[model samples]
Target: MKLIRYGEPGHERIGVQINEVNYDVSAFGGDYDESFFASNGLARLDEFVKANAGNLIAIAEEERIAAPFTRPSKIVCIGLNYKDHAEETGATIPAEPIIFMKSTTALAGPNDQVMIPRNSKKTDWEVEFGIVIGKKASYVDESEALNYVAGYVLHNDVSEREFQIERGGTWDKGKGCDTFAPMGPVLTTADEIPDINQVGLWLKVNGKLYQNGNTSNLIFSVPFIVSYVSQFMTLLPGDVISTGTPAGVGLGFNPPIYLQAGDIIELGADYLGTQRQEVIAFQKN
Candidate 1:
């Protein structure tokens, strides 16, 4: 099942995509948040969709789409999980996954506008594969990692290079800006992706492709990442764990390229779906 959430920004409702058509599943009476995942919601939602197949309303083409699930407790990310991406930035391969956190406020719709934070010049993009936890996990074993995964998501790990590398602090600052974590046109359930490791992921600025790589290049496999992360902290249901990006980020270029207002960023992964965000200047509130 490809899960979706759509409507006005704050009033987004539950939905499911079938045969490329979005269908209303709100009658299932769930918001698809932490509680939903913790209580076997995927299986329940699947049954609901199947039971209401003929009666579900098809969402209009113009409705707003948001991340498939409501904001989780956190958005955990891995840095340099791809060997090529690590080398591109002139860094040694990590002995273990490099973990960082992106603030929940950073969450935005896949097609939402990506705001360049104030006083920023090095805003960059990273097309990454993301995981959605199905249940609470703490010190989970690698062999049991996949059992805790509900599905996968396409993530735009938007970053500010200067704040991330030169600001002398954790990567979270550059990574946690509002609108930096646009995710999901749809969330593809785990069952659909036969082999998650072989999936392809990519990104483009405007019309030209900039990042194109596959999970095959990952230095740490999916199960290892999940199990590894669980060892440090408890991952709640619906938590997002971004698996890191591949090579071709702006920072990798001899002369780094960054985003400017009016730029378009598009990214996608197999089964996980695609995301399209427009770059916009930061607006003061």
Candidate 2:
């Protein structure tokens, strides 16, 4: 099922997309967050849809779309999980998955304006396939990892090279800027996707292709990532794990290319849906 949250920021209401049409389901109550998923919200949503089909309110086609789920507990990411991406950044292949956390404040709607962080001149982009944890998992076996997954969403892991590299610290410094992580046209359930590892994904800057990659090239598979991470910390329902991006980031350019005000970013994955964002200079209130 294609689940969505729509309306103005902070006021979004739950909705469902069926046969390409969107219908409001807020009457059923609750935001799609950790508690919702922990209680089998997806299954309940399915039941709700079936029971209220004719009574469901239809959302206009042009209405704004928000992220399918609420702000997760944390946005975990795997760095250089793709060989091609590692090579492009002149980094060695990891013996184990590189893990980092993105601030929950970075979360934004898929089409929201991407504000270049203040004093930032080296902003970059990464198109990643994101996993949403459904069940609480700790010390989960790799073979059973998939069972804990709730669904998937397309993610743009925006970064600032200076803070991440030049400033000397974890990638978190560059990855957690407000509006940096624009995610979701929708969060599709795991069952909706035929093959989790075979999805094709791509990104473009101002209509020019920059990233063209697929999950097929990932060094660590989805099940392994989930299981690997669970060993370190409990993955709660609604927590997001971005599987990492393939080659062709701005940092991979010969002399390096970075995002500037007025640039447009378009990215997505198969079955996960697409997103578009316009770049703008940061404004301080």
lDDT of 1 by residue, 92-206 (tens): 9999899999999999999999999999999999999999999999999999999999999999999999999999979999999989999999989999999998999999999
Instruction: Supply the global lDDT for candidate 1.
Output: 0.94
Q: Each candidate's lDDT (Cα)?
A: 0.94, 0.94
- Model 1 ranges off by over 4 Å: none
Badly placed stretches (over 4 Å) of model 2 are: none
Give per-residue lDDT, candidate 2, residue 110: 94
Residues 224-272, model 2: lDDT tens digits: 9999999999999999999999999999999999999999999989998
Candidate 2 has an lDDT of 0.94
TM-score of each: 0.99, 0.98
The TM-score leader among the candidates is 1
